[model samples]
Target: MMSINFEQLKERSLVIRKRYHELERIHHESEWTVEEDALAFLTDAGLVGRHVMSQQGRWPKENTEEELKHKIGESIWWLTILAERMDINIGEATESFLTKTEKLFEK
Candidate 1:
């Protein structure tokens, strides 16, 4: 198992984003729009849900567990990319959400 902090993940996401842009330039002559990126994220997120359903036996499929794991990771990658594209600091944002939610649940 490998351990990576959010900063490392962000750096890797940026590297992948650059490669994706290169491919887009080669094939489409332009980078994808933010909306397009969001749509792609949504597509992966939907797959995560479908895989979960399959895992629960609501939808029948072989290898649901592996596919679910992949989709979950892909969704997180897309979210990190989206946050970067929108100029949001994902780590800070995640911390803020966690802190706020935890406070709300405090006894």
Candidate 2:
């Protein structure tokens, strides 16, 4: 399988988010508030997390690794949308987070 670089993901995320915003602008009567966008992001993230837990047999619902992977991808897309709205750089944020985690845990 091929791997994608950070720049590629960032560009693709921007494109996808632009398309989403365009659709929202055309379909919705008004813009969503930052809090509402945040809530949507949190909801999607929770779904992915719960799906993973279920796959681990921690819940009653049926979930597979492939399904969990798909949800994770979707969650990241949502995260990108949220990050853009908040003026956060997703690639840089991810790098900084991993750097901090490694320092904290000596990984």
Candidate 3:
């Protein structure tokens, strides 16, 4: 599979978020306009979803049998934005974390 640069991936994530927001509005749930508000909503929703999934041992009924592709896109968007805003490369962070964690477990 081909990998995408951060900029391209971020652009695609914005479109994905827009599509979901439209769908949510059609179903009478959306109440935000700016990306900032939407990003906050996504953050809350993600944490809530994680808790629910952990309790149920699986995804919600909406994505029980398949990947929540759009939600995944939303997560990627937020993570990328957060990393850029903080001036950190997430890949590098992950590498460093894994390296340190591995050393701790190397007994």
What TM-score do all the candidates reach, one by one? Answer: 0.96, 0.78, 0.48
Worst 10 residues of 2 by lDDT: 29-38
Q: Is candidate 2 or candidate 3 better by TM-score?
A: 2
Per-residue accuracy of model 3 over 1-107 as CA lDDT, tens digit each: 69787568656656766786798788877734556654775775676567558547775455432334445545666676556556677667768989999999998
Q: Using lDDT, rank the candidates from best to worst.
A: 1, 2, 3
lDDT of each: 0.93, 0.80, 0.64
> What range of 10 consecutive residues in model 3 has the weakest lDDT sum?
60-69
Query: lDDT score, residue 35, model 3?
Result: 66
| Maximum-lDDT candidate | 1
lDDT of 2 by residue, 15-75 (tens): 8777776877888956576787788778878888888789989978874677788778877
The superposed Cα distance between candidate 3 and the true structure at residue 39, in angstroms, equals: 5.8
Listed per model in order, the count of residue pairs whose N, CA or C atoms clash below 3 Å is 0, 0, 0
Model 3: residues with Cα > 4 Å off, grouped in runs:
1-67
Off by over 4 Å in 1: none
Task: Tell me the tens digit of each residue's lDDT in model 1 across 1-107.
Answer: 89788899899989999999999999999999999999999999999999999999899787789889999998999999999999999999999999999999996
Candidate 2's TM-score reads: 0.78
